[model samples]
Target: MELQQMRYVVAVAETANFTRAAERCHVVQSALSHQIARLERELGARLFDRTSRRVHLTPAGEAFLPAARQALEAAERARAEVAAAAGEIRGRLAIGAIPTVSSVDLPRLLVNYRTRYPRVHISLRSAISEEMIEQVKEGTLDVAVLGLPPAGRVVGLRGHELARGGLVAIVAPGHRLADAGEVALAELADEEFVDFPTGTGARVQSDDAFEAAGVRREVAFEVNAIEFMTRFVRHGLGVGMVPTAFADELAGVRVLRITDATARVEVLVWSRSRPSPPAAALLELFDIDPESYS
Candidate 1:
């Protein structure tokens, strides 16, 4: 019924302990319990099954939980919108980034943003591209810089390309493939490959290319970081693919072009819904006329 009751219910559902939920809500146990009891009585359904040991959400509670959280999020968003409209740019900006976007100039970008908006607090979190995209969709992350879909489209987001480059094959300096100027992806089908882990940006790009070419890669090493992939390839462990920008920097490896089918596009993605002021400002600063996808 009341927003406070909704908060209490959600807290109890998450912690699974009334005492802890009451503590989190910053109210006495009896008051929180009484309000929840009143809410259940009005709704005519038991939200939780209380045994002395552990609290469990009843079927009704499970059904109510998501909506309660949505309502809470909506209220918070409304408050942020009001503040932003009133020219208050002094709010926290939670940014998500992928560690391997070497050419993005993240340090410079953050520095400039901080210089321009000194009152705004900035927090950057490193995550795989896929995780960042999902968190942005969920409104947990204000914006993300990620290796994005080739066409630059996300279901619930508005984004634009930050940087675009083709992928290159890397091999040990003296390896057989090192001198090969450019090779087709199909040529590497029979070769042992070092690749990114599943659900990652590079992996997704590689997988789509392989599937489109009607071939499969024998991924002998599945590592998460591009640094590790290049290192392994340099040791003659396996051949690997990486963004062209970073391929030349690997000292022990010789870079070869993956002809036709290997490219990466880094996109700046944000929720399509009304974004907070700081997020909008960053997008405006980055989305230039030449490379804007949205």
Candidate 2:
């Protein structure tokens, strides 16, 4: 029932180990377990099912977790809002981005944000566009930078375009199309490709382009990282399709323009609800009106 008890429960649920949760909460194991037991007794339900090897949330714990998180978030926001009104911005800012983000220099931007709001705590994570979008919607992420094919849309969320460009092809020096200035999708239909996993936003651009042009290509190498994809192309494992800026950075691969390539759109997205003070400040740095989204 108490906030401290809820904190212990949430931490235990996240770590799935009483000892680890106690360490994370800066308390002893016995104390955290005792508090959680008190909470469970007060609620007339057991929140967790503990075994000798592992711990997991019981049905009651699953129902209690979301409300506990909301309560904690609300308390933190209240404190942050009061601080902001007193001319000091203090809060947590959780940002998510695709690994291949290039429209903005994230490191530089975050440094500037830190300089401007020294009291705010910031966390950044890299994930595929779809996962980031879902995190933003779930309120786990305050903002995100994501890329999608031109035909893709950001449904159920608020976002604005940052940049749009077509993907370029890369081939090894010894490949048959290495000397080509430009090639169409059909020309590369028979060539094996090194690309991101099938449903990722990075792979969708090339996939849509091939489908639109009625070309079917084999993805011989599937990788999650752009650097790995480029490396595969450099070793003649397969051809790759990557952003122009990324392609220009590689040394051993020959970059080729795709005549029928689809464009990738980079977008900055956030929840449709009003943003936290820290998130609003970050959005303002981008010259975006946060109130518009609200």
Candidate 3:
């Protein structure tokens, strides 16, 4: 029932090897095994089904894992809260962002936050907007920078709009529409497109626009990365649409104004409850009131 025992179990479950779990917990294998055995005896349920080759969580372990993680996080947050009361901010800050985030200079912001709070641990990950938003809601991510269609809304979380702008069409220099200064969605409907995967927040703006305009376009290349989309357009694989701010960064492609394009909105979002102290500080840097979210 000790927190240390729970930690050992979690480590074992995550690494799936007693030896590696012991290494991660900074204990000898025998000691780690003995602790887990004692814990199992106390609970009267084996947590792991262990073999020489692999370790798998037992049904009981699977049930206990979530509570164990929550307990650990609660304990850590308790300590962080105490430190924050004493004017010291020390906690883990997990941040997520879309790959095409352009509203804020993320690297510079991270650098500034790090300089101001050297004791805080920080991690950043790149994901699609939908995934990042879900992580934020799940408490796995403290904050996120997300891009969605202008009409999209953030439910069950607090979000602040950072920037909004229309998408620009990109084409290869030799393409028929390359020289066109502006084109409508219907005009591009007959052209093949290179775009983000279907249903991604990045792709939805264009999708909604085309649908609203009653135009059906062919996505010849479904790419997960913006660079790849631009590359496909550059090589004449297909035309593509990107945020107006991001379009200038892509080389070897012609940027065209979309006369009837949907706008992309970049937003900063955090959990309405349980944002860590470091997350609060970062939000303060952006002049956002975290308490309002709560």
lDDT of each: 0.83, 0.91, 0.90
**What TM-score would candidate 3 get against the native?**
0.93
Q: Model 1's lDDT to the true fold?
A: 0.83
Candidate 2: where is the Cα deviation over 4 Å? none
Where does candidate 1 stray beyond 4 Å?
1-79, 149-152, 211-216, 288-294
Taking all chains together, each candidate's TM-score versus the true structure is 0.70, 0.96, 0.93
Winner by lDDT between candidate 2 and candidate 1: 2
Question: What lDDT tens digits, residue by residue, belong to model 3 across residues 186-212?
Answer: 889789989888888988988999998
* Model 1 worst lDDT window (10 residues): 285-294
| Sort order, TM-score high to low | 2, 3, 1
Residue 66 in model 1: lDDT: 83
What's the lDDT for residue 149 in model 1?
43
lDDT of each residue in 130-175, candidate 1, tens digit only? 8988899887798998885486466777776677788888888878
Question: Which parts of model 3 have CA positions greater than 4 angstroms off?
Answer: none
Q: Please give the distance, in angstroms, between residue 108's alpha carbon in candidate 1 and its true position after superposition.
A: 1.5
Once model 3 is optimally superposed onto the true structure by TM-score, how far is the C-alpha of residue 235 displaced, in angstroms?
A: 2.6
- Name the best candidate (by TM-score): 2
